[model samples]
Target: MKACLILLLLAAVLPVSAQQLPVDAVKGDYIVGALQLPEAGVLELQSPDGQLLRRQAAPAGESEFRFVALQSGRYRAGLASPQSQGRVWLTEQRPLEAQLPEVAAPEAPLASPKLRALANELGAGTPAFWAAVQASGAPWIEPIPDHPQSWQVSFLWRGDASTRSVRLFWPVRQGDQERFARLPGTDVWHYSVRLPSGTRLAYQLAPDVPQLKGAGRQAQRRAILARVQADPLNLRRWAAGTPALGGFDNIQAEHSLLELPGAPPEPWLEPRAEVPRGRVEHLRFQSQQLGNERRLTVYLPAQKSAEALPLLLLFDEDAYVTRVPTTTILDNLIASGRIPPLMAVLVGNPTRESRSEELPCNPRFADMMAGELLPWLAARYPVTREAGRTVVAGSSYGGLASAWLALRHPERFGRVLSLSGSFWWAPARPPGFVAGGLDDAAEGEWLTRQYVAAPRSDVVFYLSPGLLERSAPSDGPGILETNRHLRDVLMARGQRVIYREFAGGHDYVNWRSELAEGLIALLGAP
Candidate 1:
């Protein structure tokens, strides 16, 4: 009797503080929505103010939900997938409105005056006729960034007699998030952050400057950005001195302890380090929480440069041909030139609970992609900045996420390639948020309804699922019926839809076979 009364009182008090409102009706408010897809991942909701609130699962079909508006200001509807997050512009001016009660800002970060001077000097090195700017410097000209990812960036210029540490300082996310870079293999910083996916913050660096008192407690490790100079043109031009190759020569930890067959001619050749290719990179990585640092690996077509080329943004690092053996399909296709030589970013997924964070349908993910990932990638490669030229692709939970990114940020990406998308899965729900998700049959109908409802999106999609007839006769019937229904609904809505089926189950092999065909459809090749 006492327990029952406590439960009743708890429920009553909860609504008074954490109000429960319908999702779809969330006008002028921000929320995160997630749904469990039938096969792979969860569907999530993201908004413009860096928050995730709504969620719905996929039916191997359409998934939907509604939010109630307890307050009105500016709101956007967001969706989450494995590697990406997106939001619909429900309002024009999407500013950050307080989700909870208003709070005061944290104290300003203590500035290292010496580091600041070095950073400021680096920021002013614009070129005159390009070559003259290069010749004007006699001793040393360090790389300076205009819009660094962190509040401070510092580095040491190995020089004779004495060495100076250059640093740059900037605000990170105006107080929301920031970016930082640290020494290779030394993420001595960033031990306190437990952020969601797609969080963007500002950062800077100082060359060999004194370390801050609470470095790890406040920021992620430092990352290197492309050269920044005094002029906008300098941002476009490369630095005179090459960035450090870091440790391409010392490949893996196992290299020192191995004596295997065909260890290759030079056993000293390490994986990719600095740039975006090979088995590893010199670039620093971040985790959604205080965890281990991830080494980035980039896959670029031969002859890739900072020029206009077909770009495919991959969320899961392992989805590439090498990891997932995706190269087989690409080899057959690209060798025959079925698809153009494109750049692929195989960023590894986040750590424990990062799946829910990065794949969140929250505004933070979009900011991360736009303010974080894109800027990082653009620094390394000559990327196609236009949405019409770029594509986003993923599989399982990743696939669902790919679709969500296209749905919200159509202006940044054009084509979406989803394979074995786990639209049925989502980032795990917080404790006590036991909201029932859509079942297969019901979800299929909702997708059908969305096709009938929402405006025709300015994106192209390729969907392929295998035989589910043996799994659950109900789900099998649901798949076929839902597929056909969505196809017709999309086509009737004037969408260019491409649907196909394979002879396997829900795995990488099936998705691999379908990749070529999907490429042809999206790439517009014969």
Candidate 2:
């Protein structure tokens, strides 16, 4: 009886006829499995904590399954029956070029054609090669022989024996970190990427990022911030403190600017010595509808007229005033006759939380803007009451709010200027819906659907979304896709729409230039 009980207990504790095979794979490689099953079952790929990552159906005959390893970790693969089980260990490896950099001089081939040619001439990773690179400046931008629209950008870092890793903190892709590969037997590390000729962005480099053992992926990734700083080789710096409109709080956190040759000209960014300036008055405004008090920065054109001037109500007052030179842009545009003389009310948020609550298609907020704020502004200044001459403009969530307000009160705001609008926003989601997960198709594009359902209004729109604002595979439609969808919906309704895609990301750096372009498109002189 004791022996029988021991055998039963062992059977219950151990897997029956199951073998766990250890498999190795590199990050970004797909792991495929061919299996023979006696009965129809399901194959499941799970995380370390047993959370199902993927599932595939397996028939009673031979079957195959594949899963891409996105990160370095241990994953569990199992069938419905415990007889088939395996463990996968995914690790990240440097590219082949980085591992084989000691090839014969003048005959060696490299992943980058430019680097190959340079290696043929001066030898790879030699002191003379580095001297030439330093003199030529970086990140080294070279035109692709056949591709005129794109350029190859190579970022280089000089590392010593103590250096373990180098990461690039470019904000083009969310939650993705790029690393530089070290050349074999040399102190040179490099990573190259292709970008459109019109690309303009800010980036930082993190050298020797510490490895945090047993920490989550995000916590480990964020540890790079300890060593993150502007590129030493890149001379151009962004957000260096200038003054009221161009000042940043932290000078040490300044990023290196990368402006391609084809980037659009920001003619209105800096104050011109020849152009007349605008006056900005700071005042406190209290909203009874929303029961909040906030600051408002009012911009009056240099040339004052007795007649009512066209009005612009822009959200995120502080950002427009400080991060972007709004007053300077307005002055230059008005002086050059690109746009008519206009008065602008830069709307401020009462609190950060209030901005979240009020900016995303809030009816009460739109009502306050139309019923309370419009009347208040008309009483204080010689602003227009006609909708055709009035414009509501903002970026991101504020962009969504601008469209919502105009749709809610067309008589108050006829023109909407939205830059990288958050059109993939829905008011509600189904229970257990995970954002940016595999099953994220619950609800989105609420405002676009609202436009389709509601009657067409006499509202003109200027929509601009960056080409780089694309979402990951798990996430739903991103800013660029949703903006295009909104533009199509507006055109289908016979509304006048001007849509453009910029070769940048959802950044204030891009929005500053896009703002002037949007104003010229909507309210420019005919």
**Runs in model 1 lying further than 4 Å from the true structure:** 1-284, 287-296, 304-306, 319-323, 360-363, 424-453, 469-485, 524-526
What is candidate 1's lDDT per residue for 1-526, written digit by digit as tens? Answer: 4534533453453222111222333343322232322222234334435365434322221222333233453333433443433222221111123222222222222133433353345432222222333333211122224522222212212222222223332211123122232222221111122221112221233222222222252211221121111222122221111111111110000000111122123211123233223222324466342243433455556544466767676655533423244444444455455677666665554332344445534345645665567667787776778776677777644665676676667778778776655444322443122222343333334324534767787677787654321234333333334445556776887877777754333434344456666776787564
> Which regions of candidate 2 fall more than 4 Å away from where they truly are?
1-110, 120-123, 208-226, 240-252, 429-441
TM-scores for all candidates?
Answer: 0.41, 0.72
Residues 321-340, model 2: lDDT tens digits: 76688999999999999999
Candidate 2's C-alpha lDDT?
0.72
Q: What value does the lDDT take at residue 163 in candidate 2?
A: 65
Ten-residue stretch with the least lDDT total in model 1: 247-256
Q: Give the TM-score of candidate 2.
A: 0.72
